[model samples]
Target: MFLIVEESGPWKVDAVKAGLTHSLADFRIVESRVSSVETEERIRLLVLGLLTKMSRVRPNNSASDGSSVDCEGHVGYEGEGEDVGRVGERRVNMGNKLSSKQKKKRKEKVASSLQIRNDFLTGRSLTTEREKCYDPRDRTLTFVNGDDDLDFLCEDFKSLRAKMSCGHAVTPMSLTNWCRRLLDQGECRFVCGQTDCHVEWPFEEVCKMALLTKEEMEYFEKTLFRNVAQDYLDVKVCPGCKSRVVRADLSELSVECTTCTAAKKRPYMFCWQCLREWRGPAPRSDRCENYGCINQPLETLRNCLHITFNDVRGVTGCPCIRACPTCGLLVEHNKTQCKNIICLRCKVEFCFVCLKLTEECLKSSTHFQACSTGVAPRQTSIPVWQRK
Candidate 1:
């Protein structure tokens, strides 16, 4: 006789026992009571039935923590934990493997912002490779039609064609000369010289378009820094080392040259007004001990030549060079443009004829017409010394 036992959740044990029986083969007969062939076949059939029922049972879907219950009422978790760990590892690896282009792009973004101190002291390049949208070396000029106008401010615009950001075609030589002219004229903003198209080109963009060399770029930056510094601060060139120095105390004319003092191993100072070695008292706003130590800038303001406007009439006794009312920086008029000129230093627009704010001047008369009050008397903040 054979005894067949059935249980509610004994499928796991039964499956393991069935596996052992198959592996042990004839040894299973010696380990237990010998049974008939029919009894052994019945046991095999019963184990198979239990395994089929367990395989068909579905895992519980109501578990909230990604855990499921099997037919044996035990908890088993999903593979999401392993997947999340793998994703975190991938993110960490990606952070350390940034490409060179990505790093360069990040650097360029920071360089684009204006830093006045950095620009004035160490200087900033107006031209960088990232700003070079149009390179003549790798690019050829494209003409829309045979009727393209090549009339730019530069005479050499016709030869060695290269298009600027403003859509005007210019040669490298011509672009260089034009930009240099603007800088020499104390123009901080580089505007397109093409007539009727006064699009302002960024400094970096201009550097690339002009194909400036290292020496040319340095010169441009230096000139730009000098122009900007002269507008806002009382800057003077050190007589000892010829390095540009800023006056810390505007009330005192004497300025110490740190560069020269460090080089000479002693204190070195210069007269701000005279641009010579400081010979007078420690801190005197007026003239130094040296004879004829007058303010040259003030003298220029008092004795500058009178200007005559080309288009506007009835303008007389207006100085060709006028001091900016705001910053007192000397600005020269081209005499070919309108009566009103913008001060490059202070960026204040005033009448070159009436010497009043553009808004106040325009209220009384048109740009081409004479000012309501003829030429205004020159206003100088510094008292001009009469020549003895």
Candidate 2:
């Protein structure tokens, strides 16, 4: 028998040779030494017993201390135990906890995705794509029906205005301008544009449809009834302020304007028939007893004497071509030196640049000295026939 021992750091290896004892060269290696094998088996048994005791004791200790013990491969209160069993148990528990957290996160992600889908399908989402239907810059309302959508650029303004009078749809400012043009063209009556609809609208109703302001409506009425109608215009020009006035029915021939009365601070009445100052009740006569006055009808005087709507050159066809600043006679600037015009009726010199008396012009002949004529005039879009 022979024994061999090998040492590698902390580990020991023991071998024994045993044979039939015939010759020394005929021995064969059999097994480890009995003492070494018995020591290794005792050590394994001790380790297993310590692991079992630790597993059974750890729970009791944790319960008493009210805290969990992490004993994966770590020595505890008893100093040493089996590391493999503790490590295996820790790995299993850790995997279960991680899987539970991962499942919860996945469920939350799915729920958020479903909420977004529902908002989009139900048309509750606020998105940029939906804002293109209307422009915020225009500040105009859109007309939307189940199938119809009308933006700012719809049908023509005159056509829309005809429809708007019957409350079909709202008309924009451009449509209002068309309505005004039609009124200016002597079309006082309006009818609904819808098919088979015969709703006649008055001039005041057209003004309402156009959404004119109080001042604008008054101006329009004055222009339509007082200025445009030649034979029917019953208004007289106030000598005090040049404001127009219409006589009340069945009233006396005396006329007084609010503007004249307010400015003069005393009672001021004029003869309605002759436009002369009414100092006292006068016996009815063919004309007012003003000096050098011939009896002429006030309506004839107010009427435009020679209204030529058309001309050879469209540029010179404006009915209000020019009026004499001195005597209010309508005159056209046809000759040279027209800026320094001399009114034949009044025999007064007037400056065309400032439309003031040319006597105020200095002796140096600077007729337009104080005039701010720097900005060129803008061309009119209306044709010659429609200028009136």
Candidate 3:
């Protein structure tokens, strides 16, 4: 028996020959139809109906050989068409269905066998001979618990760095980069990365690290020295700029406040002891011209006297060995006045005689008489049995 499908258009003819068996319900065309007015769906339905009719035909009632349907839809027999349809039917039946797992395994196998380009998702192969994976724990590569592992490059911050207090390490370059970024966003502080430590990043320490150049480091060091002198050594601040005056000799009674001196383009001198700005040519005088000023024994005066007196001059490297009874700062004395001395700092009128602090020294004579021989003999020197 022959099944001839009349093609409605070129698509139908091509569809029949190109294995539309799945869409056509396992029925392959026996002979293709070249002309018809029907749609593809209608043509498929018509072919299906013909295949159903062919199945119902009696065994001896087959159509004649090489006979087929024309455009008019007359049925004909083409000897080879029945054989092709039977083969398609057998193929449809014998094609086995695969489970999900089997399909996955087949896909994996095909992927493994194929040489795929590296798109990052699939990893790249190491092409170098020395590209073997190395263990940092290897003794030859790294020491146990060494800083090598902790070291990191921070090009943005621009320096190599050591581990911080909490054992976390980052380069100064990285810290600087992060600091600038955070500061731009109005952040005041940053915490250490070490969770347990939780220490705030110190602004001063970071500033020191960030100042890597020679000029910057020198400036920072000088600034630190000035701060130390002002904060610890009681150096006075400039009344003009509030910067600490550069006093190379702390014991010097006279100081020219450099900050104030630079302004107005003239000499502006001040007393280091009183912090009083000196006026006129008096700063150039042998003594501070300011009356009632306690800085009578100026360091310059003592140095001048040292030139006169060869004896007791070289006894002490510093002409001023006596510290302020109140502030303990060394003050130069020419020994011109009475032993009753008042500290410029703290302004306590303490007797220079035996360093005795007594208001009586300024008023009464008894304290001076008691302190006359310098320090009084130790009370411990007297026998306990003769205790007065």
Identify the leading candidate in terms of TM-score. 1
* lDDT of candidates 1 onward, in order: 0.56, 0.39, 0.38
Runs in model 3 lying further than 4 Å from the true structure:
1-227, 230-234, 249-251, 279-292, 295-388
lDDT of 3 by residue, 288-317 (tens): 556655543333333432211222211222
| Pairwise TM-score winner, candidates 1 and 2 | 1
Full ranking by TM-score: 1, 2, 3
Give me candidate 2's TM-score against the actual structure. 0.27
- Tens-digit lDDT string for candidate 1 (1-388): 1111112211122222222221111111111111111123323433433112211111212144445432223444554222221232221344756799988986775564324223312323323311111222233344222222333442423333556677876655567778898889886567887679988877666665565654567567656554545444455667787766656566788788877788999988788888889996787887788788987777788788888788887777888887766556678988786788886656779887777889999999988888988887765555221211
Clashing pairs in 3: 7-33, 67-77, 157-173, 157-174, 158-173
TM-scores of the models, in the order given: 0.47, 0.27, 0.22
lDDT tens readout by residue for model 2, 43-93: 453343322222212221122232222212122332333353243232133
Model 3, position 125: C-alpha lDDT score: 24
List, in order, the clash count of every candidate structure: 1, 0, 5
Cα RMSD of all models vs. native, in order, equals: 33.4, 45.2, 39.4
